[model samples]
Target chain A: MTNPTAAMLVIGDEILSGRTRDANMHHLAGELTKQGVDLKEVRVVSDEADAIVAAVKALSDAYDHVFTSGGIGPTHDDITADCIARAFGVGIDVRDDARALLERHYESTGLELNPARLRMARIPDGARLIDNPVSTAPGFTLGNVHVMAGVPLVFQAMVASVVPTLTGGAPLLSQTLRVNRGEGDIAAVLSQLAADFADLSIGCYPFQVNGAFGANVVVRGTDGGRIDAAVTRLAGELGL
Target chain B: MTNPTAAMLVIGDEILSGRTRDANMHHLAGELTKQGVDLKEVRVVSDEADAIVAAVKALSDAYDHVFTSGGIGPTHDDITADCIARAFGVGIDVRDDARALLERHYESTGLELNPARLRMARIPDGARLIDNPVSTAPGFTLGNVHVMAGVPLVFQAMVASVVPTLTGGAPLLSQTLRVNRGEGDIAAVLSQLAADFADLSIGCYPFQVNGAFGANVVVRGTDGGRIDAAVTRLAGELGL
Candidate 1:
């Protein structure tokens, strides 16, 4: 069976403005790869409601799973939940279950459950809460769309809670052969190898380190034996 | 006048597979912001032809300018130039100008201008070449789409060469105030302040340092005086 495909939507003005270098997308991509999910596309948009709504709807409809990060906080600009609810055509409110979770967390920490903080409890209808072990505010899963916080720590924790529930396919296997030659020098052999092993994905990444040019040829596939055999043939062709 | 909007399409498989973190997006974002161009959206798609073509078409239609990085290399997977041509329904081939530039650079460097390396000279019809000081391979500008290299040094050089040719708007001005309190604690006052400065964009970003929570309130506008006045009022309200 083909691996489940996923898309990530990162919502934030900071990222779009170049004020923040997005760490969540890289983190999520690595994590999803390890879980046998193919992360096909990623989008980073400003914290605009229309943009968020459009991106959420498009990704949700196209991919098996859509994960979003950021804009789920307690400020006026934190409008991700509302936009998501609108995208799914569902009503949203401060649900009792979510409020209870926040209430308990704040009470234990001696913090007030103020209106702004309570806003985090306003989840879309028919959504399951994803636990936030680092902070009290919980993320939610709504119809294959997993909404998570922007903070790296909280986002990582939420991913931990969410990944186990997902049905993953066979993990992608890869092997790399480093050829200390320019990609142009090795292109013909690699191209023929790629055509031979049509099932595997062959990619050549060029690099220049300390004024030395080289290429790392990576072969990826789900089947370990196929990838191993392809790598062997690639190594032989390169005479490495 | 409203600032001209721009979108970035990053094409690569290493980024999607989490083998490499993208540096071009952040670099381009900062440069575009400095040029008074509003970077509205960014999408990272794999090095597949269909994916690149789809992203290029979408971004080109939505924004005033679209910048693409990656896949313009000398390997089989380097299909960005062809995809760009397909996206615009234009004919593409190894242009004389680009080929001449590569030939000169290769001759000077004592390197072979082999078939694979020559593939980098392929460019769409009716496109202007963007100079690459770091490498001989030239990027091209077709319509509003500026396609550049994925390597940071070459990408930066290409951006420097291309940005000056485009018209710019008033530079975006911003002021930030750090309030050493939770975002919820300052939400009401900030919300009112944001309403008062409707001409400016006020965003509150929450942070936690040494177990103490605080928020950074940033006010951005094209007008320096308005941004300054808004920051003064915000400082007064926060008693800072």
Candidate 2:
């Protein structure tokens, strides 16, 4: 069976403004690959409603799963929950289950659930809440879209909670052969190898270290035997 | 005048497949911010032709400038040039200028300019070449889309070459105040400060250190005086 396809929507002005470097995309990409889901595309947009709404809707429609990080905090810039609601045409309000989660956490911490903190309980209609072990604010899953936090720890916890529930295909297998040669030197043979291994994905990643050029040829596919075979053929052809 | 808007397209499956962490995006983001250009959106797509073409066309039409990284090598997966040509409906060929640059570099390095290496000279019709100081192969600009290499060193050098030619607006200025307070505690006052200083972008980033919650409030705008005033008011309101 074909692997489930996914897309990521990273919403934050700080990331776009270059005030912060995003760690969530790389984390999610690695996790999704391990879960046997094909992450097709990733879009990072600023904290604007129109851009967020359009991106959410487009990605949600195009892929099997849509994972979003950022803009879910209690600050005024936190507009992701509202955008998701608008995109799905659902009315959002402070749901009892989510409110209780926040209430218990705050009560234990000797903190009051102020109006701003209460914003974390706002969930769209008919959505399942994703657990956040790192923080109290709960992310919700409405349809195929998963709304998670921007914080790396919280986002990763939320992803760990969500991926197990998803049906995954065969795990992608890959083998890499790092050759001490320039891409131009290996291009001809690599292209022939790629054509021969039509079902596999043959990728050439070139690198330069200490003024010497080299390339790492990676062979990836679902079948372990095919990847192994491709790597062997590649090594023999390159005389490595 | 408002800042020129830009979008970045990061190509290559290594990034999407979680095999490599992308450093080029962060470098570009910081550089663009310094150049007084607003990087509004970023899309990470694989080396697929249709996906690359679609992203190039969409970003080029929506923003003032589009910067693309990856898939410009001689390998079969390096299809960015072909995709860019298709996106603009232009023919591509080994232009004389680019080929001559490669020939001279190869001659000096004592490397054969084989057919595979010669593929790097392909340039779309009417496109101007962006010099790559790190490598002999040059990046090119077709309309507003700049096709750069996947290698971080080469990509950065190409950006440095291209950015100086474009007109820049006022440099974005920002100030930050780190407070030992949770987001919930500052959300109310921060919201008011944001409203009062509508011209500035007031951002609150929360962090948890050693089980204690704290936040860094950043005030950003083109006007220095306005940002300072907003920061002063915010600090006073927060009692910090």
Between which residue pairs do clashes occur in model 1?
Answer: none
Docking class of 2: high
With candidate 1 superimposed using the best TM-score fit, by how many Å does residue B191's alpha carbon deviate from the native?
0.9
Over the stretch A210-234, how does candidate 2's per-residue lDDT look in tens digits? 9999999999899999999999998
For model 2, the stretches where C-alpha displacement exceeds 4 angstroms are: none
Q: Which pairs of residues collide in model 2?
A: none
What is the TM-score of chain A, computed separately for every candidate? 0.98, 0.99
For model 1, how does the per-residue alpha-carbon lDDT over A1-240 read when each residue is reduced to its tens digit? 999999999998887888779988888888888899999999999989999999999999999999999988888899999999999999999999999998998899787899989999999999999999887798999998999999888899999999767899988778889999988889888889989999999999888788778889999889999999999988888788
TM-score of chain A of 2: 0.99
TM-score of chain B of each: 0.98, 0.98
For model 1, the docking class works out as medium
